[model samples]
Target: MRLNNKVIIVTGSCTGIGKAIALRCVAEGASVVVHGLEQDLGEAVINEIEKDKGVLQIEEITNEGAPERLVELAVKTFGKLDAVVNNAAMILSSNMETTDLAFLRKVLDVNTVAPFALIKAAFPYLAKEGGCVLNIGSVNAWSGEPNLFAYSVSKGALMTMTRNLGDTLFRESGVRVNQINPGWVLTETEIQRKRSQGLKDDWYKDISSVYAPAGRILWPSEIAAAAIYWLANESGPISGQVVDLEQYPLIGRNPPKN
Candidate 1:
């Protein structure tokens, strides 16, 4: 119970990595506020949390000032906030040549701006509790891919925000901020979508072998484990770091397996 009695707000918890992180937090004894745009999936996540006897709240965070509302709800319902996970993100594939300005704005709004606003809104509460912020960045932030221009740019900004916030909080507020970059996580929906695209079992096998470099694709829960470690109070000194949970060598050189 590393997070015993803590209150954590996870954005985009209706599905994918966010949902997994919310579930893990509740399992670790934290009261979780699940925020998403989808009411049905959001309520489903909250129900699952409640079934485990964990305190859970749900909020829709698509509107302007929604992040502030989410932080307020966490405090009013749980009495305090210990951690915030900026896990909500939207992925769009369009090269610079074909990308529209409106689509870029939408991507940036949801992926970058929303997280920035959430951090600002959650900062006061987290600072009061000496809590942590975990921003869900992407591996593309470091390496660029052609079609994922906007997503890559948004994640790049997110990483910068993590560093700036960490420094600011350290000097002024005592709150820790870090980032987690997940790679090729195969959630249920993603798997199903791949199947619908006529991808066979062998296609997935080839994908795991050729693309992920770990000989397998990651599960959402695996990424959640990294977040859990960062959010737990024991990791107080490990701030301002961008942790890559992609199982790839940081220096681009694969190390010998022990």
Candidate 2:
């Protein structure tokens, strides 16, 4: 019950890390706003949370005034807000030659700008409760793989925003902001993505030991655990941090020899 009676908004909660965080928050006794872009997945999450006496709201965040509307939904349903997890992101591939201005703008709009919008909208509510903002960033923020060029750039922008807002909000209004840079999470999207690339069904066996030092990449719930830590009141007075949740050191990491 680490988050009893707390209220949090988790964007992209219809699936993957976002969904896991929403479920974990509900289990910990928090009312959650399970925000996402897909209806079926959102409904599934809402059904699961309902069983635990959890107040879960399903909303989409990809339109004009979406951030404000989402915050309004949380307050209207749960009576207040405590925190926000900016987890909605697009992971499209684009290398040097393929990355165009439009592609980069689209990536930034979702992966970077939307987060800033949501936090700004949720700020008043969070400030009233001395709440926090936890952004789900990536190891890609450390200048990711060439295939993830646009994604890496967007995440990098988000990392800087996290620090900037953490300092500004804490100083101006007592709200804490932090970012978690997860490395190689084995989400459903990743599973299918790997398969589409012609990897075998058990592609799970293919991760290099050096990349997956623990013998596996991260799971969504592991990231959720960290989210709870940052959201819970017990993690007091700390802000403006980017935590790296990777098996290997991110900076200057080289793949091990076969």
lDDT of 2 by residue, 3-80 (tens): 999989899888999999999998888988887767787888888986533444445455788899889988988899
Best by lDDT: 2
In TM-score terms, which candidate is top?
2
Sequence-dependent TM-score of model 1: 0.89
Off by over 4 Å in 2: 51-60
Worst 10 residues of 1 by lDDT: 52-61
TM-score of 2: 0.95
Cα-based lDDT for every prediction: 0.82, 0.89
Q: Report the Cα lDDT for residue 117, model 2.
A: 94
Could you tell me how far off, in angstroms, the CA of residue 258 lies in candidate 1 after the best superposition?
26
* lDDT value, candidate 1, whole model: 0.82
Superposed Cα RMSD, model 1: 3.3
> How many angstroms is residue 167 displaced in model 2 relative to the true structure, after the best TM-score fit?
0.5
lDDT of 1 by residue, 8-34 (tens): 989888899999999999899899888
